[model samples]
Target: MIDRRHFLQSAAALGAAAFVPLALAQPYPSRPVRIIVPASPGTAVDITTRFVAEALSRSLKTPVVVDNRAGAGGLIGTDAVAKVAGDGYTLLFAGVPHLTTRWFTDNPVTFDPVKDFVPIARVSSSALGIVVKAESPHKTLGDLIAAMKRKPGEITFSSGGAGSTSHLCSVMLNDLTRTRARHIPYKGNGPAVTDVIAGQVDFTCQGAPSVVPMIKAGKLRGLAVTSAGRWGEIPDVPTTAQAGVADYLVASWIGALAPVSTPAPVVERLSEELVRIAQSPEFKAFCASQSMYVDIADRRQFLGQLPKEDAHWKRIAQLSKES
Candidate 1:
């Protein structure tokens, strides 16, 4: 029933609509894509970034490389990538602190955590554990809390660095228990944890992936986990809330992000690939080996949670000062 001219016009519109997705996928990354890991080369972020990059490289049919830029508690690397061309080829392997750390600092950073970037996907999240040297006097988390309560502001703890997630964890612990603890900032968790093992600092919080082995070996004593529920990775470990401090939980998650101006279709494609990457059996095993859990969500959910994280940043910053 359609005339030739009308059929041609309809076909033209349908073809144009189809061309958008086609163009979006048009052999993207005709060259190498750089995934920026904004931390030391051997840290959890670095290790997982490498794994995801390898899987993504094979899936995307492009050689995706990881660039480790470490400094200023990950700010240096974030800033570096923020200025790169908005093409999909350049992306950041960002940690959760991308939202939290800024409020704690007085210094003005050049990077806009939200506006300057687009979230591709939330790859994974892990809990932190408060640990001390195996030979310490604080036999239990309750004892540590009692000691702090009795001498408010006297107990001391160490963190990976100023404004690091470890530091925020210490701040959160102080707020929850209504105690005061002195903070000692170090270069990274490895160094701060070294001091804990050496009894240089009283205690500190570290990610489960790195601390579980030490706890198992009896080198470190885990007092409380920073997640809401107990993790099977350390069956004997209790969550901070379960350890008598109500409503205590902190997590560190890594995600892929691109410049905000990148086209939505491009970002959607990237997110789909990320979800696939997370769903792969190999990636699941990889996460289990590290005791990491995927927080995998599409863009809308990620964007919705950004505001909640922003509010949490303010609370932690205020608590850091109070502690």
Candidate 2:
């Protein structure tokens, strides 16, 4: 038989352990939570993250604030969040560039992305669009490639920012088509798009979230989707691969992550709310209106995808280093 003192001590410890989660669950949001967005105000990732923060605030009856820390190709902001304490109060709402099918050694990394954070939810995905001036000479992907072949580096392309989805996708486009298009990295997609419209840059590839409306208004001409398949919003447009640049596919995605070592229960609770918000009809309508798609990946699935993305970027970075 166990001694009375030992038995009592054991019982007390178990009781306290059980009560920790209960006490934490009692009141989740006693104050406002901060969400760190790794981009500027107008990009698709920032827009989507703001929407999620709104929904999260309403659902949790708490204040969810978005803090934009845009610079150094998203690395500056990402590192900020990674260094935060493992408290549920700080979250990083980021895109594919920060964490995706890429590797650090092959690409560029300011931090050890794989170890710094834990995945919570994969909230959404946005396809890229091939955009050119409304009065451009190239009417299709083939036309652009043919022209590029005629004069390497003569064709200039703009991107949202250096090392962004726009930049990576454009480089991938060149890699696939065996042509060269000089890169013009702007501070944000808006400026780049403006320059393209003014005929300063030859073309740009960015997420549909920003270009769809421009394409609709005839301010910009959309040539092809930078996705594997066609876009539902712009059915008439063909994929870059389908249009001639075979194997051309690129997209932007957003996810929510908390610091590693945060209590599993807290992470799971937040994740549950994310899933609920994602499935809401209002959220779906908002995404559709923006020409984006909602893709649900639970914690397990989301975490599993991180390494694959890291590897992909690592290879890209390495190649970039070589060239």
Top candidate on lDDT is 1
Give per-residue CA lDDT, model 1, range 61-172, as digits (tens).
8999999988778787888888987888889997766776666556679888987888888878888899989999998899999988887767789987788888998888
Candidate 1, 315: how far from true, in Å?
1.7
Compute the lDDT of residue 244 as modeled in candidate 1: 84
lDDT on C-alpha atoms for all candidate structures? 0.83, 0.81
Cα distance off (Å), candidate 2, residue 160:
2.0
Question: How many clashes show up per model?
Answer: 0, 20
lDDT of 1: 0.83
Alpha-carbon error at 219 in model 1, in Å?
1.1
lDDT of 2 by residue, 1-323 (tens): 87999999999999999999998676676788999887889888888888999999998899999999987667768888877777789998888768532342244564566677888998788889998988999999889889999988899999876567787787777777778888887877888888999999999998887788888888888889977767777788888777877767676778898888777877888999998888889888878888788888877888998898877766655554443
Q: RMSD in angstroms, all models?
A: 6.6, 5.2
